[model samples]
Target: MAQLAQSITPVDAVVSRMRALDATLPERDGVAVFNRVYLAVTEEVDRHLDAGAFPDPEAAITLDVRFAERYLRVAEQGCPPACWRPLLQFRRHPGVRPLQFALAGINAHIGHDLALAVVDACRTLGCEPADLEDEFDRVGDLLISMEERIREDLMPGPDLLQIADPLTHLLGSWSLERARDATWSAARALWALRGLPDLAEEFCDRLDAAVGFAGRMLLTPLPD
Candidate 1:
């Protein structure tokens, strides 16, 4: 989409494609809100990659692209997992705040997509989760950093974020660190169940549903 050369790396391709999406989508659209947040993280990843931060660049690139592909596929199909469905359905709703959209997308991506992406990368690279741990941790750290920024940028002022504020309580309920830990555990579990496709599928489905439930809660419309 970016007219990238045939030789462009997978990571670059993913970044370029996201840039295109960011350019095309409406600013207030839910997908656009998430895209901006995600794009910032991806761009940071790209910077780190270029700076020789990742111990396994190839693995990092593969995992990053695979993870992003899950979300992109949903965008292309106009259909997404239960975890993502609520966000898409409410993308244009006026009651949903930008912060809600951003966090919901983050919930869906990190909670569900990251686990699957790890398995996908493992299969593609002929490696295991242990081998990708560094990449996973590095990416997770970037996400955590972005999460803080998202809150600071999208959250209401100090006075508005009072103890009784619903937004404050809502934001406090979800933790990116907790989600990252769970995703790592899920990836390990999924990898172990590779031989048992049925079990793995069930596990993934349950995860999707649970994540979707959280996302739906996060998207609860509030008074402006």
Candidate 2:
């Protein structure tokens, strides 16, 4: 269960707290911005999660992106963005910038996956499909903003060991296989949803399942 600590709701308290964290930063602005932004966003998210509003699928899906963006941004370069890493690793360079951009993209990917899970669960509801589509568009806009923001902070193009390999023999083993696997799993899950009316009840389960699959991947072997 990946601890799932990121926010799924975008609330005012989150923004306010993020701003406050940003305000308290000392001089020397290399990775401090990452630290401040991560704290502010995480605080904003944690503060909004209540029994009624947060645990619900709608709110959690939204805030997860906010949390992921914060984590990706603050993760300091050249490491898995764990809790304990030296501050000195966050060196500025033309290289290794794409890794940051790609990590930011991972946040968007997680949000997108969550949204799909929600929609799958809500397919039988009275809510029109258009509402889901509109919500997706809104999320897409946020993703765009994150992309632009990351681009501002990171250089474009591939670098670093963790960089996405688009032009390598690993594409088939790494990227395409994962896509195919996800597609097959999705088809099977959709098949399970057929002839079911209590879809709303199943959304969280499916969402969690999908998230768990990713969590397993993150736990796999990595270079030292």
Candidate 3:
């Protein structure tokens, strides 16, 4: 298990793990839904890396691997951060929409795990968050683009877009752009607090709780 975990650093290896997970999960499983979306995004990132799209491929790979490991951890172990609890807890609830599951997972990932991934990459590369800014922005751009596509593909048609539709309101309530910005801020803040472990832990706890609250809201079951 330790060896397998260590071997997950390569993008191809991580992609394989996600693919295997995708095969095992039912189509409607909340974790599977998010995993499918994430797998596509990661594949795209791999393509970008192969094409030399990132200014520093090593840094990009490190960050991407570190970021992905968090989600993979949740799949391997039932344990997850507070921000992810709602999605996993309500994975099969009939009232929850697929789009809600995807967005809630994204909220947990971007709002919590991403900041830590940045710090992880920085520590591994012996650099600061600022040094990886370009890679971060590019990766973030891809996630934002994927999110736009997810909305278009998962959002209900116009007939369901009436003013009274809760899905519409729910969709409006969350913004990937806002989440991305906040994650970047949180990453820098976390990096600054690395020297103070106690304070850092407190900040992380608060962030986990706050993001979890948002995710819980996102996963609210809607009426048919």
Q: Estimate each model's TM-score.
A: 0.93, 0.35, 0.94
Q: Residue 187 CA error for candidate 1 (Å)? A: 0.7
Per-residue lDDT for 83-170 in model 1, tens only? 8999999999987888889999999999999999999999998998999999899999999977888988998788765632888778
Better of 1 and 2 by lDDT: 1
Structure candidate 1, residue pairs in collision: 83-212
Reference-based TM-score, model 1: 0.93
Residue-by-residue lDDT tens digits, candidate 3, 44-80: 9888877767777788888999999999999878789
Location of the lowest summed lDDT over 10 successive residues in candidate 3: 1-10
Show how many residue pairs clash in every candidate, following the order shown: 1, 8, 0
- Residue-level error in angstroms, candidate 2, position 99: 5.8
> Cα RMSD to native, each candidate?
3.8, 11.7, 4.3
Best by lDDT: 3
lDDT of 2 at 209: 53
Candidate 1, residue 103: the lDDT equals: 94
